[model samples]
Target: MKKIFVLDTNVLLQDPNAIYAFEDNEVVIPAIVLEEIDNKKRNADELGRNARQISRMMDGLRNQGRLFEGIDLPNGGRLKVELNHRSFAKLQETFAEGTNDNRILAVALNYHMEEQENPNPRPVVMVSKDTLVRIKADVLGLTAQDYLTDRIVNMPDMYMGYLTIHAHPSVIDEFYTYRYLNVNSLHLAYPLNPHEFVILKDEMGTSKSALLKVNADGKKLEPLFLSNDPIWGIGARNAQQRMALELLLNDEIPIVTLTGKAGTGKTLLTLAAGLLKVEDERKYKKLLIARPVVPMGKDIGYLPGEKEEKLRPWMQPIYDNLEYLFDTKKAGDIEKILAGLGSIQVEALTYIRGRSIPGQFIIIDEAQNLSKHEVKTIVSRVGEGSKIVLLGDPEQIDHPYLDASSNGLTYVVERFKAQNISGHITLERGERSHLAQLAADLL
Candidate 1:
């Protein structure tokens, strides 16, 4: 049986193309959702962009027929703008508020009631990205679900970019002697992806092990390009970080993703590799660092200054890492170093849109705050001869509509894991400090 889907404002804001995702199922857009989208259509952010895009889509649909009655979608689904279900009569007793959420719930509840009156009723699902909305829907005895089109389902067991295999003791020795081993020699149960990291352990249970990477051909295991060499004075402290560096420094792999908790050295390692490639090796003409400007807690509101000064707080973390890499002795020293280098640019992700970036090493910090579309827009802006590294902890996202499973960082990690030009590593250990590591684990 065909179902009916009621979309909340956030679902459309997170993904403008969600209207077409229901797949021949009737999609209902409450009138309140249009109002909310209109309110957000003018502001300059991802939400505003999505709101405008959705408006344009609705406009295009409007030309075909009256939305209030119902319009046939290209995918054989029916789209309708519901304007009559705004009354809170059904929810006044329990909800007791005329808020937008309650209004949306009212619309879904009305559809549910109408379906019940029919001899054969279709399932009514309220799709939203908000947890409270889903809970309230359940309280109202309405079926609800998350917008899962872009969500990575098995997030807990998602790809970690590496695997451990126990082989014959001689396999480890052979890898060391030959410097490379064919995939068939491992007698593996699963196929290894290109550039996937491997830890070959001794089957006899000795302390012998070797770290290797699947070559681009995905047919051989090869030793790391930089075993112990430090990049820009920063060395990998763990096996995962070592694997990350292997991908970060490789020119053939143009996209690298690093994910970890608060202090797993994701940003530090990425910055180190970017600096080396842009400065020491001169492989790239510039080092461009950008990150979404999502606030962590209560926002500090606006500050008074020019663009650079206004962006100082948001870019301070990047500066701190650069300060460490440059070993700046005093305040403002890193800024001077950046100025003298003349090849490094640090800006918000906002300014990066619509520009074709080439011959640069780009590092997108806190990438987990970005939505799938936002990340796609930024990455698609990469021109030839450019490499983009996205680094963030999926669990530490700050975007209101994004979660660990749906955020762009995890999304890219899963989508690009099998591609030859992309590589990913999830750092498990925190190397910031003993206290930081303990705090990350315990609290």
Candidate 2:
């Protein structure tokens, strides 16, 4: 039987195409959700972008037929804009406020009670991204669910970019001598993705092992591309770090995704490799770094200054890594060096769209805050001879609509795992400090 789904504002803001995602199910938009979307459409962020998209989508739907009275969707689903719902009876007392969430809950309650009285009632499920709204729905005896069409992977089974395998003692010795071995000889648990790292251990119980990368052909495992030498005065201190550096320094792989916890050197290693490719090798004309400006909690509004000054706080982490790479001892030294070089650009991700960037090494840090559409926009901006590296700790997502599994970083990793032009590595050990590592693991 067909079911009815009442959407909250957040679900539409998180994914504008969500109205079509339920597939043949009745998707009802509360009148309050439209009000919220109108209020958010003028803002200047991803949420606002989505809100405007939703507004345009709804307007297009209105062109077809009256929205208040249900309209037929392309996928055989029915879409309706519910405007008759109002807070009634226990709703006002239970919620204690006429907030938009409560108003949306009232719509769900109205539908739910109507269904309860029907001899053969269709299920009414309130779909929202808000945890509190879902909880309140349960209290109101209404079914609620998270809009989960964006989640591509579960937390436990997320691709880690690498796995360990035990090989015969001879295979290990052969890998050490030959610097490469047939992938079939190791007998991995599953087929390794192109560019995925493998730690080949001795089957006979020896401590000796070799860190190998699956060749782009996926036929053989070879030694890391650049492991022994330091790049921009920084070298890999752990096995996973070595794997990350290999992917970062490889120009053949145009895109790389790095995932890990805090203090795992994901940003540091990517910066080091970018500097190497841009400065030492002169492979690219510039080193461009950008990150999404998603605030954790309360936004600090606009600051007074130029673009660089306005970006100082949000880009401080990038500066910290750059200053360390340059070994700047005094204040403003890094800025002076960057000004002298005139080859490095650190800009916010906001200004990256509608521009084609080429012959540069682009590093997008904190990519977990980005959505799939945002990530696609950034990747599509890459032009000829440019390589883009997306670095993020999936577990540290700050975007309200995204999570560890649903964010763009993980999406890129999963989608590009099979492509030869892309590579990924998940750094495990934290090299920041002993205390930092402890905190990352324990806290």
Candidate 3:
């Protein structure tokens, strides 16, 4: 049976194309949702951009028929602009107020009642990105669901970029002696992606092993390009870090994703490789570092300073890594070194839009906070000869609308796993210190 889905303001703001996502199902837009979108349309951010796009889409749909009376959608579904379902009698007892959220819920409840009156009643569901709204809908006995179209992968089964294969002692010895192994020599459970890391262990109970990467042809496993050498004096402390370094330093792969919790060396390793490529090797003209501005708790708005000064607090983590890479022991020494080099540029992700970035090594830190569309915009801005690295902990997302599965970092990692130009590594070990690792594990 066809169902009626009531959308929340946040769903449309997260993706303007969400109205078309429900195939052959009635999509209802609460009048309050339009008002909310209008209120946010004037801001200069991704939210405003989505609001404006939704407004344009609604305006274009007006020619089909009256939205209040309902019109046929391109996907053979009904698109409606519900204006008169604002009565909150059903929720007044539970919610006690007619807020926008309550009003949206009222629309769903009203539709549900209307459906019940029919001989063959259809389902009335509320689709929202807000968890509290969904919980309230459940309390009110209404069906609520999250927008799952943007979710790419779940955390428990997320891609880890490397897999271990138990092989015969002779195969391990051949890999060690030859420094490469043919793809057909291994018994594989699944297809390997380009640049995917692999660990060949001796099955004869010996301790012999070799680390290899899927070559560009996907037909052989070649030894990692750099294992003993340190990038900017920061060596890989673990197997996952070594895999991450291989992806970061490789010119064949243009996009690399590094995911882990705090103290996993995601930022430090990325910065080290970026500096090596841009400064030491001169492969790129500049090392451009950018990250989303989402705060851990309180925002930086209360601080009094200019834009760069204001960003210093958020970008300080990047600077700390750079200081360590540059061996700047004293305070202000890193700044002096950066001023002299002029090869590294640090900025927020806000200014990166509407600009084409090329011939640079780009590092986007805290990328888990970005939406799918935001990630698309950033990746699309990468012109030829530019390599972009996205680093974040999927479990440590800060965006209200984004979670571990639906955020852009996970999205890219899942979507680009099959592409030859992309590589991904999930760092499993926390190398900061024993205490830090214990805190990450227990707390």
Candidate 4:
């Protein structure tokens, strides 16, 4: 049976195309959702962009028919602007204030009530990205669900970019001698993705092992190019970090992704590789680093400063890593170093929207806060001869509508795993410090 889906304001804000995602089911848009979208349409962030997109879509739909009565959608669904369900009589006692959320709830409640009275009743569901709104919907006996069309993978099933395989002792020996082994030698059930790392262990449970990566052809496993060498005075502390360095330093790979807990050296390693590529090798003309400006905890309101000063707080982590790499001893030494170098640039992700960047090594820190659309916009800005590295911990997402499974970092990792130009590594160990590692695991 076809069901009726009532959308909340956040659902549309999170994904502008969500109206067409319900298939042939009837989609009800409470009039208050329009008001909320209008309020956000003038802002400068991603939310405003999405709001304007949704407004244009609704305006185009108005040409088809009267939206209040119900208009036929291209997907065989019926789109309706619910005008009569604005009454908050049903929620007045339970919810005193008739806020936008409560008003949206009232629309779904009225639909549920009308469905109960009709003999041919359709199921009513409230779709939202807000947890509390979902809870309130459940309290009112209305089914609620998250907008899950953009989710790429669950946390447990997320790709780790590498796997350990038990092989005959001879296989390990052969790999060590030849420095490359064909993937068919494994006789595994699944094919290894391009650039996927492999740890070939002795089947007899010995300590002998070989670390290799699947070549771009997806046929052979080759040894790492830089196993023990340090980049910009920083070396890989673990096997996964070694794999990450191998991908990061490779000029052939134009895109790389690194994910891990708080201190697994994702940003440090990326910056090290970027600095080496731009400074030592002169392979790229500049090093451009950016990260989304999502604040954690309660926001501190507007910051005071010039453009560079305003972005310094958000980009302080990048400067910290650069300080360690540059061995800056004084307070403003890193700033002096950056000024002298003139090849490194750090900015917010907002300024990277419409520019074409070429001959650059780009690093996107804290990429887990970006949505899929935002990531696409940033990636599409990459011109020829540029490499972009996206680093983040999916478990540490702060975007209101994004989670581990739905954020853009994981999405890009999964989508580009098969391509030869991209590589990914999920760092498993924390190398910041013993205390930091313990806190990450326990606290």
| Every model's TM-score | 0.93, 0.94, 0.93, 0.95
lDDT of each: 0.90, 0.88, 0.89, 0.90
Query: How well is each residue in 1-443 modelled by candidate 4, as lDDT tens digits?
Result: 99999999998988898889999999999999999999989876778888999999999999999999999988899999998674689887688887889999999998999899999999999999899999999999999998888779878888889999999999999998898999999999999999999998889988999899999999999999876888888998889999999999999999999999999999999998998889999999999999888832223246786778877888899999999999999999999989999999998887777999999999999999988888998999999999999999998988887889988999999999999999999998899999999999998
Candidate 2 per-residue lDDT over residues 126-240, each given as its tens digit: 8998899999999988889998888888888888889888778888899988889988887665788899888878878999888888999899998886647887778889888
Worst-scoring 10-residue span by lDDT in model 3: 294-303
Clashing pairs in model 1, backbone N/Cα/C closer than 3 A: none
lDDT per residue, candidate 3, 81-127, as tens digits? 99987467877878888798999998998899889999999999999
True lDDT of residue 127, candidate 3 = 96
> Where in model 1 is the C-alpha error above 4 Å?
295-302
lDDT, candidate 3, equals: 0.89
Q: What is the C-alpha RMSD of each candidate to the true structure, in Å?
A: 2.6, 2.3, 2.4, 2.3
Q: Kindly report the root-mean-square deviation of model 2 from the true structure over all alpha carbons.
A: 2.3
Question: Cα deviation of 266 in candidate 1 (Å)?
Answer: 1.2
lDDT of model 3, residue 414: 94
- Cα error, residue 367 of model 1, in Å, equals 1.2
